[model samples]
Target: MIGKLGATTVAILLSGSVMAAAAERVEVFSTSGCGCCIGWIRHLEEAGFEVTNENLAMADLYAKKTGAGLKPGQTSCHTGFVGGYVVEGHVPATQVKRLLAEKPDAVGITVPDMPAGSPGMGESDEPYEVLLVARDGSTSVFARYPLAEDASR
Candidate 1:
């Protein structure tokens, strides 16, 4: 129970908001034309994250992503930063919170390509994986969603 709210009917409430307030705000970099990127932004907002967006050209965006030490296959529709970690693709806010909480040694987390069932990606009922790209460029499964097993490259 948070903010005088009961557990009952909590489904209609924004639990993410409670979690969001203490969470790190995110800085996003993406092309303004990508609808999925916008959706991802909305997802963050709904999760109670204070997100600042920067629209950059594809070349510039790619430059930033790579400059941040991101590797190939870890690329996604967009990039974001929270705390000291980079967030790539339509990563779930829950995972972001987990990442921040764990404070892992990594460049960031990525959902790979625009998997149909990913956060911003449209409905595909496909499974996907969120990969935590370590600082050394090695990768590991950070989190798994039954319907989210195919996203991370």
Candidate 2:
């Protein structure tokens, strides 16, 4: 019984660690000079994401976004890819995790036009929306920020 219990405990611990590592990997593309993008990357890292980033020219970055199926209105300064989904803009890390958990059948999510008080955009009383962009370029509100509980953050 003791040996069986020990084996089960080890299996559980290893599975948790492996899953966390695999689930948190994200790849980002942005301009090297974009400070806000850097901050956003930091935000993901703080949320336990394993981030790998590449800097591109603005034109190249835009191309990358387009290639990722992000339309003009859905664009942001930086773009990220994780778990077969695209992430655009200053979207909160929590929302990203939620997206992964829900596994929506959409192209990805975006926070259009870097809103203040977003994950890396500093604090603000202004509210913002995270849009879930569909494969055909339609968007719907995926999440909203500055919730009553989040005001303290």
Enumerate clash totals for all models, in the order shown.
Answer: 8, 0
Error of 1 at 32 (Å): 1.9
Give per-residue CA lDDT, model 2, range 1-153, as digits (tens): 548779889889889989867977999999888889988999999888999999999999999899989988898899999988999999988889989989999999999989998977887878889999999999999888777865432
lDDT of 2: 0.89
- For residue 118, give model 1's deviation from the true position in Å: 0.9
lDDT of 1 by residue, 1-153 (tens): 555666655745566655556457899999988999988888888777889999999999999889888888889979998887899998887888889888988898988888776777766667788899998988899977643343321
Q: Candidate 1 at residue 31, lDDT? A: 91
TM-score, predicted candidate 1 vs. hidden true structure: 0.79
Among these predictions, the greatest lDDT belongs to 2
lDDT of each candidate versus the true structure: 0.82, 0.89
Error of 2 at 45 (Å): 1.1
What CA RMSD would you report for each candidate?
Answer: 7.2, 2.2
Which residue pairs show backbone clashes in model 2? none
